[model samples]
Target: MTTPDVFMPRLPWDAVDPYPFYAARRREGDVVWDATAQAWLVLGHKVARNVLAAPHWISDPRANQAATAGRFFTADTVAANMLFTDGPTHDRLRHAVRDVFGHSFISQLTEGVESLCKQAISTIDVDEPFDVMSQIAWPLHVAVIAAWLGLDPAQCQVLREHSPAVIRLLSGITDTDTLHVGLAATTALITEFLPAAADRRAHPRDDLLSYLATAPELSLDEVVTTAILVAVAGHETTANLLGAALIRLITPTAEGTRLADHIDPADATVLTELLRLDSPVQAAARTATADQQLAGVHIRSGESVLVCIAAANRDPHVYPAPHQFLPGRPGPSPLTFGHGAHYCLGSALARLETSTALRHILERRPVLTATPAWRDTPAIRGPHHVPARFTA
Candidate 1:
């Protein structure tokens, strides 16, 4: 296949309904080149999975000069982020906290997460329109992670206030003022907030901060950076997933009602299906370490590729009636949490939190009271406000 055969569609960075844009691009061909993004867009399920699982496709942006530009961070800081690293460095960083997100550890969090969900649900007034994202999902997620990290109320507050700034930094926004604020927020977290949390511990406690800060294998800088990653990634994706799940649950369609009533919160398959239908994290970026042929097209070394997880999840070849919300639909797992070595560490926790939260909310027999206003973060898709009311 030649370059001319590849479709180049305008990326819908600000589209309120962007799935159609993904569908439009996918219709042309799965492996299209986007001139605007200057990256190969992998919109098919098989191709996206193959790219994610391939060892030659690296996560490090430094390998590609174009991938490194427009970000405000120093090269060292970018390299320090495990999400952007590969090989032994990635393994060491991931292994440090791997067990923390395993089934045994996540199982222990179930009861506490359930209690937190119930407390959040109890605060909602019946028959009154309330933003579920703010009132329920966000608070519940923040509380869970804060407790997991053993952060005091003040430290948790600081995290809450500065998280958006950290998000801006991660989003690769090039606006001068925004980048300054983001840099300032990141610096404060590294130099002040995290250090304070570490200092509060006289000896290492059985918490995330203690583990990261006192680990023999990790340096102080590594501890601080990893902690920040934990704090930001810990709640954001799961909160967004919960918000999206709630929207689907509260839809007035007959299938929606059936799913709300019948879906088993503990059933991983059902939850997996939900994740496939409405993935929170949309796209993931990677750079080629060497020349490769992906889905029949040749990709040069140092070239970037954007794996469209949302599009892959809804690929008709993978899932029959791809757009419908079918809880028991059987197929290969979705790419919402990604694939291979870089699979999300907090996936188990996210699942436990989402399911536990949904179990409680479904008990109230909630319904949508108003249309949701979605956030414009194309990489991370979720509603900013989800107004809902409970019948029971």
Candidate 2:
């Protein structure tokens, strides 16, 4: 008789470097019981894709009792935003942003994006090791997103400072006080800025805010919420990706060198491969809308499933040498921006931003070298500090 598989104990390493843990689990099969988060961890390429694409999996935190129990999202203006909603509500709100964030619209911002990248890179000191996260990636992402959202430089700084806290709250990690402060900052900015922008757009202007303001059937609060969502979502995830990509570039590998040598930055395939090996957004939660069996595991209705994008990206079944940073590795794309109806509205913008920034870095500092003191955090996996010496 065949034996039932043994469940593994949850460890801190699972949070840190989940690739090895996921690889071990995937060996047993596509699905494994994750004791740490008390959810069925789906790891294989096909299973993960099915889970993400399935209509039965919902992104609304409110659908899961545990997800909404102590959250401040109930009080925040973000509650009106699409990120936390489902069904028609989500579709309508998402369309409002998606229209403006479409490929045709984002393509026009390439010059602005390239300018931001050049400006950020020009300021970096080539002779010394530097925190590229703070000096380059953060500023580039902030400037690009702010430009897209029609916020002035000063307001952009405010958003940048408060964004980490806001994202923490969204991730259900911050304390009540911290969450309140972040929410208040966001609300104040959106309330003040959106109305004026909306009014200007009604009269017609070139900026995105004007377009959003003039969009049919979208209300004032919807405009504000949409702008706020774009600013936060657009910047933070790409910022993380830039940092993670830099870490991969510094790692000793022939593939890394080849990636650095690729002159044309519009190569989405290479960037996608790098992202698959080292994904920025690690996990996203979804609640099952009904009792469903996924990859042989029974997922009850309303249970929260943490889709580990990082782990899934590295599934060996799909990606050979999955753990290695192979910039040219060919396979299915990673779920960094998610999939299906909820695919990131700002994905084109993000790709443009990252590719622009990386191209600038490579052109100027092709042989950048960093020290061994790079620190990786648990929740956000990237170099907290990347001390690098570059040749300009």
Candidate 3:
């Protein structure tokens, strides 16, 4: 079969609602070669799951012989963490921190998470269009992750300033200035974490840094990189998800209001549906280690595959009325937190934080005063600012 000639939509990355774009691609085929993305776009739910679960598809961009969408820095230590590793290396890195983010550990934090949510929510002005992204979402997640990492106030402030720049590297950006800034921020973060990691080694504490410092499997450098990964991803994903969820619920739509008013945060499925509707991390990039045929399309060894998580979540075959936000919708789990070995390590914490925050916000009866201004970062999607007021 001839490769489909469709291209990725040219809309600004931040402002563009990618659901429509995904829907369009799915119509062509489950898997199509996108000349613009310079990779095979996996648009179907099953195809994405298969690709994600398959051990042969690697995360290390350095393994790609065929061109991929993003730039990978060999010297960038961020690439050394579990997010970019594969095989035994991936397993080892993930296993080291698995227990800390396990369901049991996360369950213990429910009350604490709710308390943090309430603390942040209590300070929001109820009478005006306050920026929820800044006032609540960002600060709340940052504080939670920072506390877990045992960071001081100064370190926490540095993370707030530099984490986003470090995240920009994930988008496969080509801008020279942006790349320089991101790399420099990455270095700064490493430097900042070094002291904490060292302190933990000398005088171990109950925090994540101390745990990492003591993990026999990890070296000093490994601990620092792994800490950086957890610290950055710990807040970024949840903050983005929380901001998006709030926007959807507070947008004054009938469905939004119905769910916000009636949905129970205690029901895991409700938050699952919300995640399906607005996936913060839209796509997962993988490189085929060997030749394979996927969804009837031949994938060459070393070719890049862009598993479009946002598209797969809304796959018409998987979810009925794919675009509609229907909680308790009976279908397979969304690939929002990913699948298989590479699944998000902090999935439980993220769910807890989002649900807790939403429960608190809904209690306040938030109203969106204006449309959210979306972030411009690549791959990651969330509002940079959500203008809103609380009515309760």
Ranking by lDDT: 3, 1, 2
Judged by TM-score, which candidate is best? 3
Q: List the residue pairs that clash in candidate 2.
A: none
What would the TM-score be for candidate 2 when compared with the true structure? Answer: 0.85
lDDT of 3 by residue, 132-161 (tens): 989999999999998788899999998999
Query: In model 1, how large is the Cα lDDT of residue 204?
Result: 78
For candidate 3, the lDDT comes to: 0.81
lDDT of each: 0.78, 0.68, 0.81
Candidate 1 clashes between residue pairs 3 or more apart in a chain or in different chains: none
Relative to the true structure, candidate 1 reaches a TM of: 0.91
Which portions of model 1 miss their true places by more than 4 Å?
1-15, 66-71, 171-178, 197-202, 254-258
lDDT of 2 by residue, 1-392 (tens): 11247332122234445577776777887877665555566677777778877888876665654443234455344346777776787888777767667899889888888888888888766675666778887778988877766777777877787676556545433334554666677666666666666676667667777777777757777777777777776787788778767666655565445445543555777688767866666666677889988887888887777677777888777888777656667677788777877777888888888888888886666444545233333334555555566677
**Between 1 and 3, whose TM-score is larger?**
3
